[model samples]
Target: MTTAQIIYEQYKVLPKRIRQELKLLINSEDEAEKPFSLMEDIEQGLNEVKLIRKGKLPRRTFADLKREMNDAK
Candidate 1:
């Protein structure tokens, strides 16, 4: 049998909760490897803002970032 058929056969033997958990684990892993979508980027940025607001992320001004970039060269 093909690899997919083999996997499906194995998956069929898993209990319902185990199957659901496995599906979630696989899907989350797949999503983690994908390039960020626009909406995902926006949400990430929003999360960063929350961190900044809570003083968890260092706030850098545009000039500070530009100077840092120049210094890195």
Candidate 2:
């Protein structure tokens, strides 16, 4: 069996919640790793989404950026 097959078998043994959390920790922007793992990026993204939902962090907007640039000049 290939290394990938082994890893797949190991991952299959993980508890659903733990596997999900591991995915979150490994999140990245590159899709190259996506075929290997989609749940990873999604889990991290979910946290970002939740933070924005809570209003604790400033939400991003195109108009806000324009206004800031204009003010700087």
Candidate 3:
């Protein structure tokens, strides 16, 4: 069997919570190498910065997050 098959066999025997954690780890590794729609936003921000050497995307302030939470309730 391949190494992945061996690992899959080992993973199948793990506890539910352990399996979930392992799944997350595997997903994160996969995400790092894969392109997704969310990454397009990141790439757009990078492109925006290139247009103006000193420009950067605005970050959400803590107060803004707090206000948003309050509004949601």
Candidate 4:
């Protein structure tokens, strides 16, 4: 079998969440070559804001974010 065929066979057996993550990874590779879109970013930010307002996601402070970034480094 070809490399892609082998990958597909393995991909088929993955759980739904993992398959979704893999799809995102694959799409991100393609996106690397594309120009940045401010509208797309605005839409994503709006969606996150909606989720946060609904209490589906926790709100985070800039200090907490900066701390996490510093810790990562």
Candidate 5:
């Protein structure tokens, strides 16, 4: 397997709460083009899978997130 697969295997064993922390990161990626970057997004995506193995927190809606994000700018 590849590095991603290896990491995924590891992620599959996390508990239920620590995994939810990644929600903060995932929820931050709804914009058309996020400020961080594509590479950063990809890295975050991997982190998302990691969180999922533990337990997926509810995903925020795009509209609410977009509205909140725009308001911040």
Candidate 6:
């Protein structure tokens, strides 16, 4: 079986309290990784800026974004 299947099988046998603790641990790990994920997003935005500067991608005005957000609301 796959590693995920093995892990799921093991997790299934865990007691309720242990499962809750595991969930907390998993959430904290996600929290720790968030800053790195934000940096990745910033890098992606910088790449998009380069594309916009080269005229490979269309750029939108802040007013256009504001209008879109208001429409969504």
* Top-TM-score candidate index: 4
* Model 6 weakest 10-residue run by lDDT: 31-40
Per residue, candidate 1 scores C-alpha lDDT tens digits across 1-73 of 9999999999999999999999999999998898888999999999999999999999989999899999999
lDDT of 2 by residue, 1-73 (tens): 9999999899999999999987877675454454635787799778878999999767878999899999999
Best by lDDT: 1
Can you list the residue pairs that collide in candidate 3?
Answer: none
lDDT values of the candidates? 0.96, 0.83, 0.84, 0.95, 0.75, 0.94
Tens digits of per-residue lDDT, candidate 3, 1-73, equal: 9999999999899999999998899899998987668889899867876765655555557899899999999
Deviation in Å, model 4, residue 21 alpha carbon: 27
Q: Candidate 4 lDDT, tens digit per residue, 1-73?
A: 8999999999999999999999999899998879658999899999999999999989999999999999999
Q: Which lDDT value does model 3 have at 26?
A: 85
Give, for candidate 4, the lowest lDDT window spanning 10 residues.
28-37
5 against 6, candidate with superior lDDT = 6
Output the worst ten-in-a-row residue range by lDDT, candidate 1: 31-40
Model 1 / residue 57 / CA error / Å: 19
Model 2 TM-score, 2 decimals? 0.36
List ranges where model 4 is wrong by over 4 Å: 1-35
* Residue 60 lDDT, candidate 6, scale 0-100: 85
Worst 10 residues of 3 by lDDT: 51-60
Candidate 2 error regions (>4 Å): 28-73
- Higher-lDDT candidate among 2 and 4? 4
Scored against the true structure, residue 44 in model 4 reaches a CA lDDT of 91
TM for every model, in the order presented, reads: 0.46, 0.36, 0.40, 0.52, 0.34, 0.48
